[model samples]
Target: MSGSGIGHDQWKTRFGFMLAAMGSAVGLGNIWRFSYVAGESGGATFLLIYLFFVLIIGIPLLLTEFSIGKAGQMDAVGSFKRLAPNTKWHLTGLMGVIGGILILSFYSVVSGWTLFYLYQYVTGAYWTEPDGGFGAAFEAWTSNPVAPLFWQALFLGLTILIVMRGIKKGIEKANNLLMPALAILLIFMAVYGLTLDGASEGLAFLFTPDWSMLTEPSVYFMALGQAFFSLSIGICGMLTYSSYLKAKDRLPAATVGIGLMDTVFALIAGVMIFTAVFSYGVEPDSGPPLVFIILPSIFEGMPAGHIVGIVFFVLLTMAAFSSALSLLELPVAYVHRTLGLTRKAATLIMGSIIFVLGIAASLGFGVWSHIQINGNNILDMMDNITANVILPLGGLLMAIFVGWYLNRNQAINNSEIESPILQKVWYNIVRFLVPVVMIVILFISLFDI
Candidate 1:
């Protein structure tokens, strides 16, 4: 029952496992980046392509990650080592381990920004009418060296504390509350948003596809990236969580459920945000700025602006928190198992290191703005390097290893699904479609060719 010599904890219930996996999948990327990317990539067309990729690429890859962890019952790196001892396949897990740490470093920095904005909303700072508008307010907040670092450290500390508590008490329980509450809040926002003046236009913008945009290659590339990123794949977060699962636990159901729920959450959040954006008469293609700069203005102009602002930011933070927990867990699980450190000790050590890295990311926004790698700031560089380079590469290796390296019978047996036909479909996807699509996405992401 232990991947390493040390015993592991099982999720107390089936629902608990689902909640944890879903929580990991549904993160800030789903709500914030999904909306903006969908807008920039041609609205409904992007949504269609994204879902297609999720079905073909994301779900199959998700099952591959789950099977690896469940079958090996180890942390990401050890999972590979256990699955295929005396082989280089374990390098995929190593990449995932490093990618997890890298992603969380910048991720916590942005999560910290969410916390700051949540505080601003609670204090009526951003809700009240401002002379320079929400854009200026966001600039002022993000550009402040001390405040951003404080919030980043605070968020990292909170994430560390949760991981310190171990699986059942910490990760499972938090998701049980957070995911459902997030869903309710998002629905409330969407319902309210639909009632806004520009609801028709917003819905049209979201549901109506611009056919010509789909002809471009970049749309497919971006959709593929979004599908992978939105599911929290390629970073070993899913693999880490699934490692704690019991053998009897059915992975295919979990995989499909998580994939569907995560995509649904993003679509719901996208519509909610777009409704507000269209209502405010602003362009939806504002990229990342749409969340911080544009959304605040939308909230401020709405009825009960203060109340909506508070709820919105709170939802954002909750989403970020859930995702951050999984990211932190991957490296902590590795350190805990390999070094034989207590969960608390491993969490503290890894969390401290990540906090320090996060500090540099925070400073890159202001004090160290001059510091640039290949014309990108530290934060942007970390993001691009991980998302564009590391994640896809990890995913590519995973697809190849799971599809080709691992025995077909082993993967199907570990999946715990009874349907032979379904297993065949999953294997074909992992073997053929995923690797090819991932290569295209990776090349486009890195060289921009």
Candidate 2:
């Protein structure tokens, strides 16, 4: 294959495609956000609801994206334009392209934090901090305007270098190495963390249900949002990735496999995080800093502490890297295909724009601290806009377009599933359940309605 060509690539194999999709789905959100959301939403109850959303909503949307991409044989925006020509359905793809860009803006900021912490762990910087000092250290780091921007630029530079190499060489090869290493490291960390004295308490906190908490409407909305966002469904990168798939690949099986693996990774991360929470008596729902702040404090008290810290932070960076690559690729794919730019040129352009946006997010913690949209600073505002509004809006459009706009027989035929009964069930979920649930959550989240 020619290195810079736009429309001339296929994944090397089915395994490669699935692993790439899974890598995109499983990221920093799985560890930091999922664990906190699960804890705040009532643990086992939240898990059950999240799994329901994953199966009923996530899997079908995954298949929908794969089917559209494979049949259309184009990038996310081009796929819609190809599939339903002369219609507004392509706007769904546009939302995804823009959404991916918005997501990366702030995502890189957090990824920068992970990169900085990885540096600290590797250099034994954490060793010098006083006991129970990670929270202060993290605050100090974020509140420093120049340092976070430096890290964000460094992280975005790494992401751009990988993506500039073209799809098969850049995306597929990176995921092939990184995803397996991530899975193995997560399992090891989970098992080791469980050896702590308060493991039982952690287990109970995760598995034991507080049924009364289910009455809170916020938990339902939270679980549903996590279900959609955690799988990387609404962001449009999945469609771009699957656009590289060959027709021989089974969409149904691939979708389910990716969803299951992503969910399992999040669960395992919860094990690692919550065990440390209970052992160290750290607050479980301490929000976004649980992994960066609390986990480091927990590690400080463990034997072979620095080694464990290095492994954990490295795993976190890998997770962030995998997802950020996909985010960067979404716009790159669009620009390369739609605007006639070379893949490398598109990648560099999009990466640079996202890096510039990330500087604002980085400064939101320090220089721009006084500015707020509804009391959220720049980073949190970017996160809120993308996660709360754009994602669900994109997802809502995707469900409707796949469920209602596209021809049913074509969708079924394109999906390449073997079972007739399963096809009917998938169609119903996409058409009805997914749209209703997505709109409800989107309204509640965006408007507090």
Candidate 3:
């Protein structure tokens, strides 16, 4: 196979590539979404199942994406095209590019919310709660129509600036800094949270399992979905990142590192958030409002609450920003590779278009609140379509392409699995197990079953 004509920018080191991949995997899905989903899904029971899925399913798929990218050495779409010339396999990569763009559009809007809260904490503005408290304050701000747009633009602009600088200097350097800061802040908060009065209850809630809930099929489905989404698999972000790696870099070790870090981060976030919630006597299953609404109220009453609030939002924003970099990079890489644009030009054009698209989602909370698709607002609809439909389908096709269609010897070589026994285990899981699970997830998500 011939290389894509565009010059490839490689990761300066294996450590840099691992951090970038972990940054892509460890985002709002782990911190913000994971908390609420676990709360509603039966806490420790869901965590057990989620761990099962991550090990049995997530790591295998992660390795699959890494193998494809390292082997093809191109942008997501270009990789498939180069690997399987004249076939429709590239469509899977195209779907990933589109999914990345759409996910970033709505994703930036929420990330902007984190920035808003962070700013409020820094300025001490949150100390003086609005008339009805943080809940009302959250509602009023989201419904303002204009305020959210500014934050969204600012957040997306930051992402564009980082990605525009190219791989090593921009994306890798930023992750090296942001990810460590995020980890420290998270660990500090979790430790502090454990010292609170309700720490015991929070631990119980998170660690105690309701084994009977295992009988409910939805628990398995939610775990499967969370495992897939949290790792940022099927979006081509991993594929694009891994393409920068040298052939000597170990794919299996990197996959394990990214997966382990992401899962451990989510568990710590759960401990941090839940201990605080239980301490303040707030409802654990507060749904989406838990972060923006409920947390502020709880913080207001805590000792040195203002400082803690600032740290929490900072952690949240860093997590979101790190992930957003990968999301934006996926499309930027595509445009640069396939369209023959310079990296700067592709970043500018794609970043600008995504910012414009995100305005609709920002407005959805306010001016466009009445507009609904299948009972979901614009932002929710975009998230549902991409997360529930596009990502799963992309993942399914990727599994089939790599597991069944790609040359077996090439796949094995790309995976870098030295042991024949381990190689067979990974291969059969990707070939047999992943496809079956993905189909079940698609069925459950589509029919709302």
Candidate 4:
């Protein structure tokens, strides 16, 4: 079963398959970004809209990516070329490859913070009662570019090592344990959080809809963007992951599983964060400050603070690694499939390149402040380019490819199951709604409020 033959193969089991897919979908994007996006928008109202878009837009996009990749049986670049045949549509896959590498260059830097903080938790650094120590520690480290660079390299190396170990032995095995641990840790956090005095208020904020937020044009656009990013659509991870998937598996079922799992992570992270933040009476809109500054300070007072903080960051670190593993795999899979490089050689080259480029992203807080573009730091620029630009544009291009270019119904019929009506509805949504939604959101993201 484990024989190597250019060895492009499916996941070993349904459990392994679920862990890999869910691991890709659940990440820092769910914990930090989802809470911030929800907090920045009108909380529950935005979440509801985001969920709606996730069903209509995210699900179809996920299906298209899976079906296309399964059809091509190759990574992003190779797969696009196979499906499109001699046109520039393949470049969309190139954009996805580049975007994955570029995004992870900064993403790993942030992930390092979780790992760093976890060590601090074990060492009791965050629980020290010095005034402003929490923010001060984060600020001082980031202000020194070399510290973040070192940590980013550490995180990158860890991910590369796992990928080099082969899918089942390394990636699947680690995530199987880590994903369950993360979910359990989150449940513990939520239960602990509910005991705090402000828990009820936070729940209200998270669950109650503030429909008037819909009156603003940007709110809708923000919801769409969050939905897209949260579900990991147009990232090439899904496309690449599915290319290696078993041909006989149902694409729609896998997409649904991924979507639901992604949503679960976000909701659970919300509970974990709200409990801590509202308990401290901290403002939710403190932006990135909430995670680094507030959480540390809150941890100072909690019983068994060090142990809890350690577990929390462990959850974060696992989430980060799982997502990073998928992203790094995209280009390596492409190289192996197209240029015929060994997986090891491809991983080393791609990982090394990403490590070097990542220094600039790590430096953004201090030495590279002058290098800002559009008043955004290196991280912001990378995220905006990937999230607001490449992804939606990728999604738009994918919509065109799947809807106009591919015989999507045949694609659907090939993997068809019991629900012909649902299949037809999915086809229609991908055909009409997703492209329309992407266009509107892209327009708003480009020029509007």
Candidate that scores best on lDDT: 3
Q: How far is 39's C-alpha from truth in model 4 (Å)?
A: 1.9
Supply candidate 1's per-residue lDDT for 309: 86
State the lDDT at 274 in candidate 2: 82
TM-score of each: 0.96, 0.95, 0.96, 0.95
Query: Every model's Cα RMSD, please?
Result: 1.7, 2.3, 1.7, 2.3
Candidate 4 residue 441 Cα shift, in angstroms, is 2.3
Clashing pairs in 2: none
Clash totals, every prediction: 0, 0, 0, 0
Q: TM-score: which is higher, 3 or 4? A: 3
How much does candidate 3 score in TM-score?
0.96
Which portions of model 4 show Cα errors greater than 4 Å? 1-5, 414-417
In model 2, where do residues sit more than 4 Å from their true spots? 1-6, 128-132, 443-449
Candidate 1 per-residue C-alpha lDDT over 360-413 given as tens digits, one digit per residue, 9 for 90 to 100: 887887888899976678987887678667766777788888788878887778
Candidate 3 Cα misplacement greater than 4 A, ranges: 1-5, 373-375, 444-448
Error of 2 at 244 (Å): 0.5
lDDT by residue (tens digit), candidate 4, 279-329 = 778878776546777787887788877777787888889898998988898
Estimate, for each residue in 1-449, the C-alpha lDDT of model 3 and write its tens digit: 24533688988999999989999999999988899889889789999999998998889999999888888889998888888999999888888998999999989999999999999999998966668889889889988888988999999999999999999999999999998898899899988888899888988988999999987778877777688789999878899998988878889988998999999999999998888889889888877668988788888888898899999999999999999999999999999977889999999999888888888888888888999976678987887677667766777788898889987787788788989999999988889899997787667655656
